[model samples]
Target chain A: METPLIRLVNVHKRFGNKTVLRGISLDIMEGKTTAIIGKSGEGKSVLLKHIIGLMQPNGGEILYREKPIKEMSREETRVFRNKMSYMFQGCALFDSLNIFENIALPLKEGTQLSPSEIKKMVGERLRQLDLEGTENQYPSQISGGMMKRVAMARALVTNPELVLFDEPTTGLDPIRKNAVHSMIASYQKELGFTALVVSHEIPDIFHIAQNIIMLDEGQIVFSGSSEEIQTCETPVVRQFLRGEAGSMFID
Target chain B: MTMHESPTQGSGILHSLGAIVLYRIQLAGHFTLFLAAGFYHIFSWPIQIRKILQQVYFIGAKSLLVIFLTALFTGMVLGLQGYYSLVSFGSEAFLGSAVALTLIRELGPVLTAIMVAARAGSAMTAEIGILRISEQVDALKTMNIHPVRYLFSPRLAAAIISIPLLASVFNVVGIIGGYLTGSKLLGVNPGVYFLRVESSILLSDVTGGLLKSLVFSIVVATVCCYQGYFTHRRKNSFGSKSVGLSTTSAVVQSSVLILITDYILTSILL
Candidate 1:
């Protein structure tokens, strides 16, 4: 009933001659967990990038709290950026910075928080992610799973309203993947913030998401509740769900 | 390449010369604006001091050992060469002038710049390129920090200050090396050589070389940083190879530009 927290209206993105997103339209409700499941190179990441204004759409607009993001001033865009968190596919932590500094960066740079305050908050996030006692270590010193958690911690440090997760469980072992999923679920549950997760891990997506959106060839093939997704007879949806040997997604 | 006497050849040479002049004018215009920005930051006191110190660490302290070693050996080699050449002319007393003129007018700053290009320039290009590829530069922008103000302008200011000082040091060290070679190794009277050098060389030659050093410092800093920072294809597509290409190109472009500018400035000033 309430207006969506974020919305993409007929968005189009093209790379050279190839069109990646052709009139993509989606509305992300406030305080909801929405999982975007699609095959590789289906513009799932492109959709997330548009929301953050990292890549502007060639056609149409992205709205944050019903305001057009496309026409926002540079200062407004920066302010908007700080209000959302993005976990890059590879964890994207600065190699030169230690975990403590990495987690503390947004708060230190964007906020007027004192050093002690930042330290206290970073410590809490580290403990939440079960990454305690590794503050002084560089990103290179940690395992991939831990680096993901570190990135998650940094993303959460700013207390963003919207968090974008790009394939959070792709590289993790099953146990670690489950661990990441649970932490993500818990964080969203407790914070009551909107999350837009892009992933191909169908089981994990179904387990964590209340809502599901399926992307194919840069267009939304299906959008519904998780239960609706499970029962949908759409060929693409069925193929993705079954993890079939050969499907329309094959080529 | 034989020097062919043809009207078309003359036109081609004129065209290339015209293109080079135009490029140099553009470079000078951009360089002037860069220098003006640096000059503005100079009055900010502590912030400027902090920036200057950081750059000094990068451009001066890090470059000391290479500049010194290069200068010393280059001086020694020049000394040996000059002594033998002077002996053939029966003007062995002119050995000091020969070494001094070579080091002051050409080799010292040019050699230092080449060394900096190979060492600092490549390193800077690779580091910035990696940052660019990794989206760290994007991250900085997202935080509303200007990459130029935060990362590059400081290095440019530091290079301006450090390169000229290093060039002076190189000239001194090289002259010392030449003196040692002349007196101890080549059996030339050091007094005659010093006298000839002091009488022949003027303040203008030293000034001209120092001027070149200042210009070369800017060339090295701007070309390297610009190449890395401006490299844009798309996200994730850029990697180490782009950085490597930019690094090599920066060095080659900066070196060739320095040589050409050196000739033009020398002709005008001297």
Candidate 2:
């Protein structure tokens, strides 16, 4: 068996008196797309945050390539963080920065690239995202789909080995959503990078994920291949995939 | 748990102590870097003079009325207090020196900084803190441009340089107010008062106050920025309460630091 690129060992998290995650364990394979599907508030984004080292699990550990994320020192974390990119759910582009500057930021800070080299690299990424002409526009100046693309371009400008995406299609129209999904698929395939995508858009992720994990109330209720999920006889998975209200959810 | 300890009680105390030490170190480091970055921005002149002129209109020119009113009352009070003290010593003729020294060397910078902290510094903290909580800071961080370099350097630079200049204006106007109050209302000799002031006051007194103002600027900017910058989470975690707390802390912390530093500088310089 291949060594998993990302691993969570009995991860747990809580907020004050309420438990948000409870001993969740999973392995994400290298260079494959993994989709985490769940209801709106079932620790999906929380799991993404754990992988990116944005939040620490209250108990247990999260590992990237056998290295525990919490054990890394500040400088080590900076280096580790540079190797992975996160596309936030809201496409959190800097409102103060134009598209070109936003995409070029990580390269300019993390690499020894000259200004012209950084410009060229940013231009290439923009071209890849079909955002070549919108380089000078601010985040607020663009549509949500274009903003998502800009964020993706920024994330990929450094050519990270792992990408964590939170609801990449969440506020876009269906057409734009499909466009973003296709772009994510193409980028993963072209770069051979590991992707952990969090979303409720089941059909789009069904086309993209090599493996699927279903989270319910902070626990991994189902874990299998996309085909396995399709064939599973569980009422929760079937109802979720069919868009029906099930007993798994209230109301 | 120890005999004296409730569950997790000692741990909380230890953490609070550690946090205090950590915050002190962070504040010192932040203020040092802030000062250096501010000087660099000032010397580099990255921002155009037109913008500075515009800010002066807002930060300095618009603040003139308040500064004047506050200074006038402050100087008048100082003069009244000085006359009584000087009469006790049979040196009421030294009233000009008393008013000038107090206004120029102490109250001028400290009071001006407190006012600016109340007016401008709180607004700055609120604006930047809201921007931070809204994911703007994360956006800047991901862009690879140091938010400190882009966002903080200019404001810190402007505050350090401008606050002292504003204080000087306040001092000069305050001394003139004192002279009017002392010589016109109190029947003191203007020539005697002016002569005593000219002989008694030194350039070092004004320098001490300006230096204090510079320190005040660094304290205000660093505390405001650090509190805002560190408290933001790139999600739905940030809100108006954090901004409000940060602004209030900036004003209070900066005011206290200004007062403490004023005493220290006075003792050292005088």
Candidate 3:
């Protein structure tokens, strides 16, 4: 009924001769968790990257709040970037920094918050992620699942309006994977931030994700809500849900 | 094994040669702009004094022991060699001038730069390369922080400030070491040696050495940081192996550039 929070139209991306995203078009609604489930190397991460301006599209356009991202001015771009955050697959925390400092970095660099205020905000995120006592510990000192939580904390530290998660729970055990999903769901609810997740967690992710977008060879074969995905008889969608699209179960 | 030449071989070879020259020029242009941006950012508002101080500690303070030892040993050797050479010429009284002139005019800055290329420069390449490989640089960009300003400019500023000071220290310690070897070990008169050292070193020589150190520092910082910053673009793909190669290339290229630059500057300064 209203304009989408972000929109991608006929986006094309290629690395060398390999066209990763072949005219991809999608819409991400506001304040909703949208999961992009696709086979490995299907340009899911590349798609997320294009949305965040990490990589520009070879063709077409990405619009944020009805404004074409590339057409925005320098100050406008800064404002746009400030309103979003990305959680890398590897949990790309600053290794040299301790957890507290890692979480505080965005707030310290991006905002004019005082030292005490930054400490308070970081402490709050740390508590939300159950990273309470690990503030002084470095990323290497923490567990893989905990590192994901720390990354989540850092991403949420800036109170962004849009957060991109790339395989947020891929390497974690099932319990931890669900935990990360639940954490994202809860954070999305509490913060009401639009989320775009490039993940393969399948049904587990579907439980938390309201909308589902399926990619097959970088082309969106299915786009609808979780219920629509389950009932859709499209061959590609069925093959993907049946774990035949070079990935695990999703239906 | 030589392959048979095709009809277009001559033209193809010329085309490739032209491409290589163009590529090299492009690279030089990129490097100039990168270094210029780093230098320009050093003057931006909210001067990153704290980060610069940290870099100075890493680049300068940590280098004290090695620079001291190298300067001392190098000076001692110069003293021994000069004394022996001048003794046969019956001019051993000029050993102070020989050691001071060599260290102040040439060896001091060259050796200090080479040492730093080994220590701080290589380490910088590896550190920044790892960050690039780990996506921390991308993270910084997404956070709206300029990676060049955050990672590179401070190191450049620190290297610019540190290398000259370290070279000066190298000269001082080297002169003292020469005194120790010539006056204390050999039979040269301490008074004559000191007097020669004071008189032989012209103001131009000292300034020239300082200038060389500054240029060498810029070369070392630019080459190494640029290598690390572009580690992902290596033909082999982005990985720890690429980072390793970038570090090695940075060290080798910086060392070669330093020696070549030294020769050019020496011709002009002399």
Candidate 4:
């Protein structure tokens, strides 16, 4: 069997008295899109954060390319970070930078590309994202959908090996959601990079994700293909699928 | 039961007081650690010259006008007050010496630092706090950039480089303002006024004031940056209100620390 590109071994995370992730163990295959779906406050974003070494697990270890992130040296960690990119839920574009400058930042800071070379790459990424003629605009000037596209362009500008997305389609209209979903699908196909997306959009995200993992109250309740999820008779899963508050409501 | 309840009330008061003390001590410890981390990165190779220059422009050049105006008015008031008091003793010729000595030793550095703490330091706190709230700082970290190296060190380094220069400018402008008031306005004779100032002011006094300004700038920058960087870590609810509170606390803490540091330096230097 091929070794997984990333592995989480019994990962656990807690904030204060609240336990966020309770012993999560999973394997992320190479060059595949995995979607994590959960109700609000279920640690899906926290789990994604652990994969990128942004937040450390309280217990257990994360392996990037089969090497433990904890054991990586500073130079190794820097290289690991360069190979991965994270798109924040709120876009997290630098307020001080324009769209072009925002997209150009990682390339300018992380790579040895010349100014013209950087410009060429950034321009190409912009065109790919359908963001032409919006270079000088600040993030606030653009609509939410455009901001998400700009963020996506920035995350992909470096052509990283793994992209971690935190709710990329949240708060977007269905049209914008479709645009983002298609954008992610096209980019994953063309770039051939592994993607881990944390999203709440149900049936829509199912189309893009090859594998789905459902988290509830910090534990993995289900992990399988989308078809398996559809046929699964789990009560929590059924309630979540129907978008209803089941008998498990807590006051 | 009543005796037990009385003991419980007494312990509750003690516990509350102890918690407050512990909280303050923890905050101080965190601030010291933050300052140490910033200093550690200061000597790292590949210095960000562009960022340093940008901070210097923001902290120094931008503060020039306010410092100039403040010094001018302060000197004029000092000259007016000193001339009148000295005239009572027939020692009005010492007006320039009083003005120059007061400014060089105490007023210039203290007032300039307070102004900077109010203006530039508050701005640094607000900007960084906003960045923290908006997750830009996290974004920087995920991009493999050290937030302290990219943010705090530059501002700290710039403030250290600029504060002394600003204080010197304040001194110069203040002396001119005093001269205009005492010599040109009050007819104390420019020669005697300048002579008294030159004779009374020592090199050590000027150097000491500049040293105080340097320390004050570091305090302001460190406090402001620490507050901003740890906005999310604060116990309060995380939002714009928290950022506002951090900004206010930064200014208050920096200004208070400046005054306290001034006292300690004065005690040691004098």
Candidate 5:
């Protein structure tokens, strides 16, 4: 299938005794938006982490562009990392650095860009994210939504081929959530980069995601187009789509 | 199972002791590996000179006033006490030797390290622990940055380079404090006071103190950084309470290790 941009083959991960991801296999297409939807604490984040080689799976393999991540040489891994970025849930901006420096850090460290060039690129990204005048402020001084947008700015500053979002709209209000959704949608359309987002925000994320993967109890119960997800009849898929706490004492 | 039906108190105590020993061994191994990695990264390519300078400012330049004040008061007190004790034996001329020796040999390095452990060391732990909790360290890894090299090697290099310098400053100020009290306030002959200090202080004493300060700096930086780096691996929730606990543990562990290492170095050097 056009040699998926990223693929996970029966990935398994466990922390001590608790298995967070159990044999999850999936493929993410190039230049498409895929949303992984699951209940809280159901391994959505863990699955995302495996894709970027952040956390190695206990078993199975993760492949990027048909190459196993585990077998990449040091130089190859570095190139792989530079080509992708993961936007943390909390923004994870360096507290000691201002927003401008934070966004400029990857470009400064990874590329041979000069100071003026780095500044210009950071300024452009900030403006694109509607964070124009907040360059001089620290992460602590910004609101939650603004912090997320700034983080997105930082993530896209390098113009990566892939971006992983970990719960991009967890604690925001509806307005902020929609803002984030629209921002991601617009950026993906313009940039045409593959986006893999892990979230439990149903219809909001579904609006932007071309494909939906539902994870439950460390397993991918369903993976299909957004329209198929809406009509899927599997019990867990139906319950998750409807946002219902299924009957507890059902026979 | 009722409390009374649980294992005997003796077994529980043994288990607790065993756990403590195991935990300490694990910590020691972790610290050794961390230090080895730090040393390795020191020689690796892409040395970040700017970060090292910033850390030097944080760990050294910013600590000047407190170190100065501490050295001054300690030396003054030593001079006052030494003069009084020597006067009873009609050997008050030895007061300068006593103050200079005490300041240069022991108090300078030990007290400076203690102060730094409380100040910069704790701050480093807290900062890194917060970074771990907020996943900034993880973000660094994803960006192909070695967290140890980017976050810690600079601090280690800065501490090693700054502690000796700070200790030297402490020694100088302390000697001045001692001179002010012994020769001026105590009515001693200034010539004898200065002469005794010159004759009594040996190269070994100064070098020994510098050596101790160097060792203490490594201990403090390594222990504090190890604590912070592992804070995220803790089983508890990654929150403010965990960070606070890690900070306290880093300071206490590093401070205690400093004193212990000081004693060992003294026993060996002296």
Candidate 6:
């Protein structure tokens, strides 16, 4: 069997009395787009956070390339983190920085790239995200959609090997949502980087994601390819798909 | 769990008291860890010279006028009071030394520290708290940048280097203010007053005052930065209200800690 790039072996997490994740064991294959879909408060974002190392699991271990994350030395941790990028749900751009500076920050802080090279790379990302002419404007001056794009631009400027996107199209309009999905598909294809996206755009997200994982109340109810999910026999998965279909044309 | 319940009442009270004590211990432990984190990143790679300079400008250079005014008024009042009290004993000539010694040995460092804590310290807390609430700090971590290195370390370095220098400025301006009042205005001999002032001050006094200021700067910076950095953990508040609470707690705790540290340091040094 081929080695999976990222593996979770019975991971668990709880906050106070609330258990957010319960014994989550999953594999994320390399160079593939895996979309995790679930209802609200079903631990989709929490799972993404654990993968990104923002929060620690109360139990079990997370492995990247078959090496546990906690065992990595400081240098190894930095190298490990450098391979991945996370697009936050809230588009957490620095309010103090202009658009260009926000996108250029990861490179400036993490890489040995010369100033001109950083500027060139950031400019390319801005152009790709269609965020031109807003380089000098701060995040406050931009709209929510523009801020989302700027955040995506920031996450991609580092040219990471793995990108974890948390709700990249959460609040966008249908046109922008499809556009963003298309962007991710094109970028993943062109860059050959693994993309792990957590979103609920239903059929739109499923179109771009090759594999899908559905979580119902902290456990993976179904995990399979996009084509396979349509034929999934699990009750919750079937109900979820039915519900998704019900809302397809209603709103 | 109600207080009037018979069997559980005593256990409940004990539990509540134990929880409070444990909470205090946890707070102390967390603050210690925050301090360690702040100091550990002080020598991190790619020295952040620009950010330190910006903080220096905010903490030191911008505080000059306020320090001068506060010190001048303090010294003038001391000189005036000293002259009046000494005239009856035929010791009016000691007015300069009185003003100079008080300002240099005690008032200068304490006032400068309090002023900086009120101004730059509050701003630091508010900014970091806002960053914590907004997830900008988490974003920094995701990008492999340590938030302490990017934020707290620069402010720490700046406050350490700036507050002592500002205290010295305070001492100079205060002595000058005393001279204007005691010698020029209160009719003490200019030569005698300055000679007494020069004679009374020792090297130990200046160094001791600088040391006190250094300690105050560390406490203030650590408290303010720690409070702001942990704003997300606050139980009773969230969002901008938590930011406001953090800022208020930073300033209040810094002020109280500065005075307490002053007394402790003074007793030890004395």
Model 1 TM-score (B-chain only): 0.82
- Model 3 lDDT per residue over B96-132, tens place: 9999999998999999998998999999999999999
For candidate 4, the per-residue lDDT at A145 reads 93
Clashing pairs in 6: none
TM-score of each: 0.84, 0.76, 0.96, 0.96, 0.93, 0.94
Residues A45-70, candidate 5: write the lDDT tens digits: 88877877778899999998999998
Report how closely model 3 matches the true complex, as a DockQ value. Answer: 0.80
Chain B TM for prediction 6:
0.93
- Over the stretch A3-28, how does candidate 1's per-residue lDDT look in tens digits? 99998899999999999998888889
Query: Candidate 6: what lDDT?
Result: 0.91
Model 6: per-residue Cα lDDT over B1-270, one tens digit each: 454686587888999999999999999998888778777787777888899999999999998998989999988888888899999999998988898889888899999999999888999999999999999999999999989899999999999999999999999999888888898898889899899989999999999999999999999899999989999999999999999999999989998999898899999988
Q: Which stretches of candidate 5 lie over 4 Å from their true place?
A: A248-251, B1-20, B235-238
Ranking by TM-score: 3, 4, 6, 5, 1, 2
Q: Give the clashing residue pairs of candidate 2, or none.
A: A105-B143
- Candidate 4, which segments miss by more than 4 Å at Cα? A248-251, B1-18
lDDT by residue for model 2 over B1-270, one digit each (tens)?
376676479788999999999987986886677657655754453453544454456556667778888888888787777888888888889998999888888899989988887877777788788778776665555443456665666666667667888898888888777777788888679999889778878888878888988888777666666556655532334588778787787889888888888888888887
Clashes of each: 0, 1, 0, 0, 0, 0
The DockQ-based CAPRI class assigned to model 4 is medium
Candidate-wise lDDT, in order: 0.83, 0.81, 0.93, 0.91, 0.89, 0.91
Q: For candidate 4, write residues B184-236 as lDDT tens digits.
A: 88989999989998999999999999999999989989999998988888787
Instruction: Tell me how each candidate scores on DockQ against the true complex.
Output: 0.33, 0.26, 0.80, 0.73, 0.73, 0.84
Cα lDDT tens digits, model 1, B1-270, are 445667778999999999999987986787567556645555533355676797789888899999999999999899888888888989888888888889999998798887887788877777777888887776665444456665677777888888988998999899888988987898888788788778878898899889989988987887777767755542434577777777787789888878887888778876
Clashing residue pairs, candidate 5? none
Comparing 1 with 6 on TM-score, the higher-scoring candidate is 6
Clashing residue pairs found in predicted model 1 = none
